[model samples]
Target: MSEIKHEVTKDPITGVETTGHVWDDTLQEFNNPLPAWWLWAFYGTIIFSIIYWIIYPSWPTGLAERGFLTGLSTIEFTSDKGEKVTTHWNTRALLAQEMQNDENELKRQKMVKEVAATPLADVVKDPTKSAFVLAYGKGIFGDYCAACHQSGGQGVIGNFPNLVDDSWLWGGDPADIETTIRKGRKGHMPAHKGTLSDEQITAAANYVLSLSGEKVDPELAAKGKEIFNTKGCSGCHTPAATGMKALGSANLTDKIWTQANVPGADSPEAKIEAVKKIIAGGIDREMPAWESRLSNDEIKVLVAYLKLLSQ
Candidate 1:
């Protein structure tokens, strides 16, 4: 192997020195020392960081008794808002104490008591109270409902109900919303595979689609309509197929076919299959109860927000 030779060069324009390193037979790395100010600044940061580590909560010693140093003590100071604040050496302890501040705690308790005492309907009717209810309810919804109904309350098709829409399986009353949030709801559609014929189930699916104003074979729909009336579909759906809110049956008149459509653009074949599958296998939608999870005041606030959605 031949030894590499150093070919140090200088630029003619600025007379800058090169580090004898070449790239693509053209560019060369400049051999320049960093500026004095930059060097000093870098060294300053190292010194400052060292001092800071000694003065603040930096080390994590395994020993529990003498693990950390308390560099700062509890000191009373005025805030930017002209309020006096007593800060503790430990951040977590300071935060815990802040949460129990006497004046703030009293105000929070008073607000909660007022909201609990007020009726849900009366709170919704009042603009001032409704504003508070909506703000508070939004946080509660984020904690509980957002997982299923989503943060915007626009639920996924076939899985959860879109709270923003006027369509509701159960009644859209404030009391109804409260009851639903507290006790939860379960909707079951019995499978027809064990009872009805395959052909009758297919016809029923097409007939159900036709009720939502979708185009279907008139002959199949006619025969399905007869079957629908006699085969117990009308028991929960009612004679007109308008759906019974008391039974939490879905309305077939509206074009809101939850299972038929999806979140994004989909093919017509997919919609048909979804409807047919529901007719054959049926579905059971259950909304878990929140009575034990949330307080009565929280439920009332959620009811107010949900009622406002349909309106």
Candidate 2:
């Protein structure tokens, strides 16, 4: 092996000093000192960082405390029990406090009062207020109603009511909708397995399908209709199969089957089973009361959106 050699040299063209090194026997690095301004700027950043660390909550000084070292701007005080506690000033906390100041808070309170005093019909007549109400309602729905009704109020079939459609288990009047949201609703359908025989249950399922104008076995539907009237189904669901709003019973005369899956043109069995299971086990649906959870103004905002959905 041969030893490699290095020496400081000058470039003939530029007359610049080299870094006493060469690459590929030709290329060399210039040996130049950094400019004073650049060096001072770099050093300034280091000094600033040190100062910032000392002035803010930066270092974890103790494992047991699970906290950072108290800095210059820290708020320190002794508790009622005489234990020392410290918290540092932060831009985020300052901004939050500023947001809750009297002027802004008063404005918000005024808006709430105005919305509450205004009737929903008149509220919707005003374009700006209507937009605010709808947006506010959508957010409230996402927070409270979305978990069960689903986002956008599409609702899961068989489990939750679909709000997109005009039909409603309870009346869809604006006041009714507001009442439902505030007080909530519970619908009870008694299990019929013990009350009716297997054959009657099958017939009842067929009769329910017939009410929806679906093609069902006429003879079975006839038998089911008779059983339906006698088995206390009409107590909630009226004789005409139009649900009673007072009881929150579902309407049977329409295509909407609350618990039925949307079956294709060929898959009628799936639709039948959906209704049959309900007859055997019954249907008990519940919507929680939001009176305590939400403000009256908030409920009105929700009603505004729900009315829009019905439209």
Query: Which one wins on lDDT?
Result: 2
Per-residue CA lDDT of candidate 1, range 112-210, in tens?
Answer: 557768876677688877777677778899999999999989888878888888788888877787788889999888888889998898788778878
Cα TM-score per model: 0.64, 0.66
Residue-level lDDT of model 2, residues 1-311, one tens digit each, is 33444779988888989888876677688888899999999999999989988887678766525477645776544443557655576665455445445596657646666766788788778877777767767888899999999888878887898886878988998899888989999978888888888889889888998888888899999998998898888777999889999988889888886666634225566666778788888878899899999987778778877877666
lDDT of 2 at 30: 83
Lowest-sum lDDT 10-residue window in model 1:
260-269
Residue range with the least summed lDDT across 10 consecutive positions in model 2 = 260-269
Candidate 2 stretches with Cα past 4 Å from truth are 1-112, 262-266
Q: Give the lDDT of residue 261 in candidate 2.
A: 61
The lDDT of model 2 is 0.79
- Which candidate has the highest TM-score of all? 2
Model 1 scores what on Cα lDDT? 0.77
